[model samples]
Target: MPCDACATAAGDPTGAEFLTTKSRLLRLLAPLLAAALVAACSTRAPLPAAPPAATPAPAPAPTGPLTGQPAPNKSRWVPVAWSELPGFDADALHEAWNAWLRSCERPAPAFVPLCGDVRRLSIASGEEQRAWMVERLQPYRVESLEGTSDGLLTGYFEPFLEAARQPGNGFDVPLYRPPADLTTRRPWYTRQQIDTLPEARAQLAGRAIAWVRDPVAALVLHIQGSGRLAVREADGSTRLVRVAFAGTNDQPYKSVGRWLLDQGLVRDATWPGISAWTQANPQRVQEMLWANPRYVFFREEPLDALDAAFGPRGAQGVPLTPGRSIAVDRLSIPYGTPVWLASSGPTAQLSRLVLAQDTGSAIVGAVRADYFTGWGEQAGDVAGRLKQNLRLWALWPK
Candidate 1:
């Protein structure tokens, strides 16, 4: 979600101290704390059931040549022929080429001269384009400084949700735009402070862009950094808008998914697992959200059929291509560089060319990558379940 003016860095925060989860006692004492709290629990409806995990694509057999051996440095270039790239010949190169075009929109200087070549080959046959790539780029395998060639690959996507133009009925939680005085305060406010403190609430009071019924809806939007909102306009028509990353409160971004894992409440720390835990522990939803101190702010973007076809702009300032765009550690793979990704995850065996078009909070390490799984529920299922072994090859200027 680090796009245009938004730059998000990863942070690991210790979980907040948990108080008792005794709902019966809390309900009895609720009247005394009425000013600061609502009833501990009510009959809350569940969110839509998460889509089933995608069936893993069969692993393609490796027929390509291997590097002579691992590079000695944390990341080293091993001379690899184009034949060494698994599934290289089979991919829809035109699709990847589209991602490459977006990469060139704010391309690194090293790639500027090659932009024209990319455009010219956009209409070429896949093989011709593959040939063009082999002629122009050198492929180097990436690894850790320790010489470990393997790393992790996960997925992320743009989520869509129902929202309201005004807060009422069950849609009471607000999604806010950045406050005008945001810059004046350092580490402006924690999630708990924002929810409970008067001054902290005052800063964001008038900046809501939309509202949702469940706090988790807003939380997921915050985590994803961007999402499509189906807004119920005052006149009863629905208009879709995107909430792209605006800025953050400068506090550390924490993972509630990870928090759920450490508490042993869930075995797999995926979106579905998080949802299941939230469903069972509705009374503690506020505490679960407050586990992360960092908060996100967003601004609206147009979401037409065309815009919805692509994803939010990445760090490269271009809309991301699903399955062909990746967020990498720029120090290891410069922006706009093409990469040969070989991964065998729970959902698929992915071996293809991807553009280093973005970066993310959790995407660290030279070999680490977050695969853009695209938009919507099915993509989300793949993204949630995908944490697999990954190897990378940077296709750079020869």
Candidate 2:
């Protein structure tokens, strides 16, 4: 889990947790939907492991989650307040997106996510830059979801969540599950790019919660988020090092384990790396890397900077477990509320803590949140590299 960084000074930009199991949707998932829709993601790092369940929605509800005990009358959530929401800049966004697509055509760096087959992109309403998504995401079109919220995530919206869970299209691609699926194609991505971090590779490959469509995409996304970018320091937060990118916990924990080894903080306890090392270690591989809990993915600035000041770049620590380290909007799901999360998307290999902490950005709805990834290049590589489906549910209070 991320070290203690005061939760974005509550009310500034909201922070939320999506601690749900791998099952049907839950009340808690409603918040997740909101964040996915409106959260202005800066940069991110790698994700951690799964967590215990959280929430109070039964899937079989004939009508919906309503009719059950009434949840507290919390404040209504509004993504990017009318005032904060900047005018839609379709042109700018499109330009950047296409550039990203172009970048994919060439050989990517070691820690980037490949977009070899980014099929049609349909970033309808609720998406920040529709024009940008549309212009850059050519061939595909953008839809406006003005008066109606009926897609997969529609019902999860505040007013809608109370009535019943809507059966809208899940994630960005509804009627578009590729046959063979993207995860099955690793060759299309950049493999064995980080020759010096075999330990990190094995740790991440076996350690994270499998999510990337290809290794290249994962590496590209990670590198892009942190590499050669202007660092934006939070005001008066010089001591704090804001970690822009954290990778997705899309792979197995074993991958994470090897990463620790490459860092020289820990030995190859998992044996797989040792096994690989025995046959033939990758060139430029580091055998002196180390890792520890204190160096886990951190969200707070000072701590992230502190770790980066001494830790490895383009690498990350562990993530926050869902149920264990989550914080939520008391109004939406009580402080100790456990919820089930089920949104019809791919998989959401998130961070160690799916905190329901407050956020101060555009996504401050009762049903929204911010994901805190650790700082630096590694974090950026992972955070920017992820794009998948998610479903959440919070369990009842223990």
Candidate 3:
């Protein structure tokens, strides 16, 4: 994800800082102007004063323990009462504490002082946590400059699959580490090139970290960006390891599901639907896979018992909490900001607090977000089908 300086340098224009400086200048000049006006009244002969300029009424200060702040470019924060948060009272606040604690690991400067309170409240009751939140933070309804509050929400999950230490016993498809010349090459190779070109294959010759049985499973792992692989070792034992996102091929990510839909091959574009289509049209599998040009490489990490309990580290550099972590556009919401998310759709009805912990190339917009469902088949099922309307409220420091 881009840093604040990078985002600024990337040419996002916002006048909030300039306006703030102008306001300070006006305040400083007010006293001098007033004194000059008094001197003119005494020194000059009585002259008719010009009609006073009509002053625009000041916007009402927000009430009910709510305050406002300027959001990032293309967005604004509307201060809202805690009562306005849907289902705020009913949500299981403790379930979100784990995510909140993770945010504390790399807390934003404004939130640094609150991390101690957040950690102490981990063991506190839900009601207690809620009370502390009400006292310390202000909920701002996140909206675009046009005041559109509704947006889209999707879901993603970690995948767990079987693998072999080497390419054998039906584990023919290989998952690779980044090629040695990855940094030097602007885009090493396209997915189609990597599969068909001898030179591309030579580049990845010895880069395989593990081999999986099915190409479809490998595709899922690539799309998800990371996965837990249960690798069969040489000694007839299995070891679980995490294959994390190392880098991409630098090509654009085109959805194979979208390609299938456009070709009239499948009505459902979810993973299950795509799998069914592939099974039925085995001959065209390569064609379907090549619909996307991007390829992701991975690096293996030991998944110890303690590490297994949490999801992979997000862009925020902290382990994600399933069901409570969300990937957001950094330009819309900075990482570590607590967000109140509400969405109702076929797959799930959710009204809960989530953290802006991670980011995806696809997750871009003032209100858009991608919810993180956990790992395994059930999570995948939900993630595959979760496309719904969303509303968000950022819980910011007062």
* lDDT computed for candidate 2: 0.25
Look at candidate 3 and tell me the lDDT of residue 357.
93
Per-residue lDDT over 1-398 for candidate 3, one digit per residue giving the tens place of the 0 to 100 score: 21110111111111111111123433533443344223222211211222221332223336443224345775677887777777777777887888899899898777888999999999999879988988888788999889999998877767767778888888899999999898999877999999999999999999999998777677767777887777788887667688888888888777777788899998876555776777789999999888878888988998865566677888999987778888888888888999998888776778888999988777778998877776655556566667778999988887
Best by lDDT: 3
lDDT for residue 83 in candidate 2, whole number 0-100:
15
Candidate 3 or 1, higher lDDT: 3
Put the candidates in lDDT order, highest first: 3, 1, 2
Model 2 RMSD in Å is: 22.8
Candidate ordering by TM-score (highest first) = 3, 1, 2
TM-score of each: 0.81, 0.23, 0.83
Error of 1 at 88 (Å): 1.5
Q: Model 2, 1-398: lDDT tens per residue?
A: 12112122121111111111122333333333333222222223222333322322122212223223353454321121111111222112332232233323331231032243221331323244443322222110111223221111110000000110111223210111111222453322122222335643443342221122222222222322221111122341112122333322232112333454555634642323433442364332323111111111112223232232221121122222212222233444433222222222232333221223222112222443333333322232232222233322322211
The TM-score of candidate 3 is: 0.83
Report the Cα lDDT for residue 78, model 2: 17
Select the stronger candidate by TM-score from 1 and 3: 3
lDDT of each: 0.68, 0.25, 0.73
Residue 242 in model 3: lDDT: 89
